[model samples]
Target chain A: MSWADTILQGVLLGGLYALFAAGLSLVFGIMRLVNLAHGDLIVLAAYLILVLVSGLGLHPFLAVLIAMPLMFGIGWLLQAYVLNRTLGPDILPPLLVTFGLSVVLQNGLLQAYSADSRRIPSGSLETASVALGPFNVGVMPMLTFASAVAVILILNRVLYGTELGRAFRATSDDAVTAGLMGIRPNRTFAVATGIAMAIVAIAAVFLGTRANFDPTIGPARLIYAFEAVIMGGLGSLWGTLAGGVVLGVAQTIGGAVNPEWQILAGHIAFVLVLLVRPRGFFPRAVD
Target chain B: MHGRTIPWRVETRTKASTVFAVLAAMIIVVGVVAPAYLPRATLQDLFFILTMLVLAQSWNLLAGYAGLVSVGQQAFVGLGAYAMFAGVVLLKLDPLVAILLGGAAAALLAIPAGFFAFRLQGAYFAIGTWVVAEIVRLLIAQWKTLGGGTGTSLPGAATRAMFGTDLVQRLMGVRPAQAVDIICYWLALLLAVATIFTVYRLLRSRHGLALASVRDNQEAARAVGIDARRLKAMVYLTSAALTGLVGALIYVQKARISPDAAFSVIDWTAYVIFIVVIGGIGTIEGPIVGVLIFFALQKLLADFGSLYLLALGLIGIVIMLFAPQGLWGLFASRTGIQLLPVRRLLRGGSLDT
Candidate 1:
């Protein structure tokens, strides 16, 4: 394909990555808790969607809608019961706990699903395409890109335009002070994680439909999401989308040069971005 | 009352430490002579334990002491193994010498890695290190000479002719394969003992105080004129070197090298993290206790496949939640005993009396 076409494809692929990163960025921004199992959670959501589609004979879109609330509940319970206990001055506990959770989730998925790669069968939508300017783009990619935009827009609204957003900001800024203000930091954190998981469900719809996924693919996705968050700068939602595009472009260009260099190129781009702009492209004022 | 002198001395060694020291020496003696009486299978298991102990100790020093909290240690392990492979395959060096080269290479890798990682803090630093490791693994996989993504094995001839294999064969009256295992086992034991002793000594030194201070509160440590960054870098480099050496030794034992196996976060970092966390993160005895328990668990859960890892993860989470200090920490607190005491006690003071 032409260079423009490749770049366009990369930008579309980035939507998927941004979708992957949105939940992680949200959690990290709100609580400074890096959920290591984030990628697995996305995969878990994808599997949930898969079961809904394959087992329950629901449409892929409908499956995601059902999965979102269920995922939100899981995230809520996980934060309230497991994760909140790990938060403290010591960084080791939260990190180790999350890392352990990542392992458990991956292994659990493996035991449940075997090692087989699964993809949500989206039928003709998977093959349908739309012409944009001189290039043809898959309808699914366009939808994914649109959904990513929608997710970020909605999250931004949730984070900025809502009363809960104020509480989130307050708790993020100073949990102790926020607690003193009767903001209920723990409950706010639960809501925030729940929302993040809900985003994971949306991301899962695109992820499961777009490509093949298996149990062990989570860490790589986590890395991609992490790279996007780092590149976008912490706490900047729009910047995450930009970071994902950059990474996606890098991978596509690298793949054009050599298929093997695709993933490596994205990682190299992240490291380079880190070298030049360690705080990322759009760092928050306080952080 | 004329010219009365204060009668007190600061001491790090305690009665328990003294007894533990004797016990440690006895264990070392037994370990050194184990190959003669033990079967090859048992020797291999001992080798695994020794190498893992070294890894756990290195990680503990980095995370528990220096507060680096890296999740990318597989970078050092993988690089160390690859460097050793290059040495043996291309440079025609003895595997023993290549092991040192591996350590050097890993330490070298740590310099740039530290530069990048130190820019991030806490949890971000952990992810940064992991990214560096992923980058390294990806790059190493592209090195076509090393069999690329598929990985390569040490030539049987080279392994057979490895410097001390013949001597081990003669001394132990075993086949060349068994001899290689014995040599690697001895090397692993030596490295483990060296790692533990070095860590113990370092903790007893002034640097140990600096490390503790940095971990507890970096700002206060800096206010006191401690170069927190420099101290952390030193710990990082040392941990990388030691872990790299252990990695090289491990690959040498396996006689084969694969990128996935070598660079595995689960095998190298996650397991080591679990071991350190389970044993007691900051204490010297924690990894020792942790490795034994880990080994026992592995033996018991060996047949369960994914369940083994799932169990380990669950156990790790439980420990982090309920016993953050680990089993050793819990024991130490309850008993008020430190077998390898690094805490200075102002003993025999008039105030104490």
Candidate 2:
């Protein structure tokens, strides 16, 4: 039963990782731009939620709801104004700009909010647990896992079943052709980034409730998110979830054997996955 | 293919080279004499600048020349530092000797690291290198002999017995710490000079031209008989070796070692990247100028804390967007002058006459 519980916990923890990777995957899929600042943006969203919770007296979930559009605007403006120019030919500009953005974001956050670690106060949900047949699951974790699934389902639906989704795919396939077809690639990229940021907000809520966060924690989270994205194969949404599960399970099992090995185990899993399948488990046909 | 070709004389050196030599000699003389009149803090600051110069030059070689932008250089820095610590503590070697051993170890690690990183392309390669560094950091944290995650200082015996301390003390007539600073300063000067000279020479060589062609177009370079992979691997290994040496020297001067400090992205990789990018990456003179500006900025804005770092990032982004070639590029283009010129000019003297 304990072993089953561990595996269950691992899977649930993977939901959080999937949340982190989803935004990164979305941006990368549409534009082929890997945002080095993705993790820092996650941290930034979490801080925004914190601000709402403390300053405005809102519940964490409600605060995330309010922060969603704001983050979207930030993301949209960032892409339209800053990142779009960096695209085409040389990969260094986008990478370097994003790298600079990461540094700026991290230090900016540090200046605004001191180095103290913070966590979202989760009223009764913090301790509340549901008794299953073999294991007890925390309510917050369950909600987080459910939210992750819903986010993926909704993203897939939007991606596959809508006009905007068509634009995204068209732009991603060939920006020139998409532009010829009257689809604005730059605008599409901005919208895609806006959507990614909205998802990032959702992930931030779960991330804030799950653990303590500080400005510096973003890069580590980014590493895990990147591992998930890469291991699941680039551009495949569901693969990211699976990659998250792989990482989570590896980490928990490593922790079970020895506590210090937890983080190490996740990294080892990422490396092993890369070694066996360099393109990842579900590489996009286009790439 | 040519209808009629005449012999030409190619001149590699210019008046600029002579001017550069004179300036370098003067700087060396100033550096050698400054410690006598300058304070300890200034020497320490110069040491920091010199070490950063070495790292920046190494990174420029990888990113600027070979088109491999690694975000995980701190991995080598940390590895080199730990190797030095291990040598000094375990093998009972002098600190200076251990620094060399540390560099060798880092070079060795670069083989596998390069193998893994080369499999990925573009941005994936960057992230892959970072992951490798993180893994190395995590593994290093578990080693109890190196004081685990908390880190350890160089033993008293090691510091006391460090090579050249007695000579520095005898010459400078200073305290032990100050004497150590003088020795480290001189070593850093030598390392910086060697890094610049080696990079310049490598860039002027045939292999360097091959590397440039490879970077411009790998498929085309391969068609022209260049082994892109092998050349990239060589550059990566060489950069790692130099970075490791700088890292070991850095830790030795600090007299302490910790995984976090050793493997710090901000301190080692990010700062170096900022320096290289802003200074004029790919040019031999860029890092030298960049390091000076960076040192100056640090001296000016050190009190602003996080804001200083924020400004650096903002400025770097602005530079990348506006002047992709960097400050040195701007200056060079505007003046049409190069301090360390690598180009060979062919003059048809007899044919012209």
Candidate 3:
């Protein structure tokens, strides 16, 4: 029974990891550009929410609603102006530019908010839990899990059902060919990043409510997100969730064995997954 | 036989060698003279620049030549540092010898790290290297003797008894601390010069051509009978060893070792990448120029705190966007200058010439 409870908690934890990875996977799927500043961007969104909450005296959830559009605009402009120019035959420029952006974002935040960790103060929502037969689960985790599912579902729907999604898929398939067919690869990429940023904002709300965060935390968060993405395989959102669950379960079980093993176990699991499936469990057929 | 003229001779020599010899003589003079005349603090700052130059050169060899942009170089840096600590504390080895062993240890670690990281391509490769570094950090953190996560300092006795310190003190007629600083500064200078010259020589060799071909196109290089993977792995290990040595030297000077400080991506990897990008990724002279620019910027704006990093990032982004080839590239385009002259020169005049 105890083991079952631990595993249940682990699965819930996976939801957060999934949310962290979804935006990363989306941008990669469309543009093949890995934003090294992604985790910092998420933190940026969280801080934006924090400011809205504290400055406007608004509820954290309501604050998230307002911050989403702002984050979308930031993401769009960032991709259009900064990242687009970095795209080329060589992979170094994009990675280097994003790394620079990561440094900038982290230090900018430090200048603005200092190095102190902050929490969103979710109040009763933080403590509320429900009995699920043998295991008691936190309401926040449940809500996080639900939101993750909703986000993935909505994303999948948009990706498969919309004309914009077609543009994204076409661009991903072959940007030059898509360009010839009248699709603006740059615009598609910008929109994809913008949409991904909105998802990052959603992930930020859950992340801030769960624990304290500071500027330095971004890289660690990026590691976990990257692990989930790699474990699931590139260009597949559902696989990312599954990967997160595997990571979450491994970490919890490792913690159960020895507390120091928790983080290490997740990393080990990622390596093990890579060893077994070099291209990940469900690699995209294209690349 | 000696008098017979060769019809087609590959002219490997260039006027750059003359320039290099002059520069080399100057460097030796400065290395010998600076310790006696310069202040201890100034020597220390020179040590910083020299060590950073070594790091930038190693990174350039890997990313610029081999096309492996590893953001996890801190892995080797930390491993080399801890290995030095372990060698000194556990094996009771001389600190100088332990520094060499640290380089070996990091090179050994690179074998498995390269195996795993080699599987991923492009951005995935970058993150893969970082994951491997994180794994190394976690494993090292579990070692209790190293103070686990908090880390431990080099024993006073171990530091005081470092080889050549007494010799340095007697020769320089300075205090023990100043003598130690002088020795480290000289060693750093030697390593920096050696690293740059070695890379310069390597780039002029046949293997350099193979590496350049591989960087341009992997399949084409492979089709030309070049063992691309082996060459890449060799470069990776070589750079790892050099970086490891530099890491050990750095820790030795400080007489301290910590997991966080040793394995700092921000300090080791990010800063080095910034240097490489802003200088020129694929050129020998780029790091020299980059390091000077970086040092100047750091000295001027370090007091501004986070603004310094912001400026670095902003400048890096601007350079990448507008001037991807970096300062060296910009300079070279305007005035076709090749400092090291790795490019092959045709001995005989072409038909047009």
Which numbered prediction scores highest in TM-score against the true structure? Answer: 1
Q: Please, what are the lDDT tens digits per residue for candidate 3 over residues B213-259?
A: 99988999999899999999999999999999999999989888788
Worst 10 residues of 2 chain B by lDDT: B344-353
Candidate 3 TM-score versus the reference = 0.97
> After superposing candidate 3, which stretches have Cα over 4 Å from the reference?
B1-9, B350-353
lDDT of 2 by residue, B1-353 (tens): 44355568886677877798899989988987888898988889999999999999999999999989899999999999999999999999998999899899899999988888888878878888999999999999999998999999998767766888888788767777777788888889999999998998998899888998887888999999999889989999999999999899999899888899999999999999999989998898899889999999988998999999999999999999999899999999998778888777776645544
TM-score of each model, in listed order: 0.98, 0.96, 0.97
Tens digits of per-residue lDDT, candidate 1, A128-190, equal: 998878889999998988998999998899889999999999999999999999999889999
Candidate 2 residue runs with Cα over 4 Å from true position? B1-6, B9-12, B344-353
Q: Arrange candidates, best DockQ first.
A: 1, 3, 2
As for candidate 1, its clashing pairs are none
Give the runs in model 1 whose Cα sits over 4 Å from its true position. B1-5
Instruction: Report the C-alpha displacement of residue B3, candidate 2, in angstroms.
Output: 17
Per-residue lDDT of model 2, residues A79-169, tens digit only: 9999999998788889899999999999999999999999988688888998988689998888887888899999999999999999999
Better of 1 and 2 by lDDT: 1
Candidate 1, residues B1-353: lDDT per residue as tens digits?
Answer: 34445588898988899998899999999999999999999999999999999999999999889888999999999999999999999999999999999999999999999999999878889989999999999999999999999999999888889998988888879999998999999999999999998999998899998888887788999999999989989999999999899998899888788899999999999999999999999999999999999999999997999999999999999999999999999999999999999888887645554
Docking class of 1: high
**Standalone chain B TM-score for every prediction:** 0.97, 0.95, 0.95
Chain A TM-score for model 3, please? 0.98
Model 1 CA lDDT for position B345: 85
Q: Could you tell me which 10 consecutive residues in candidate 3 chain A have the lowest summed lDDT?
A: A278-287
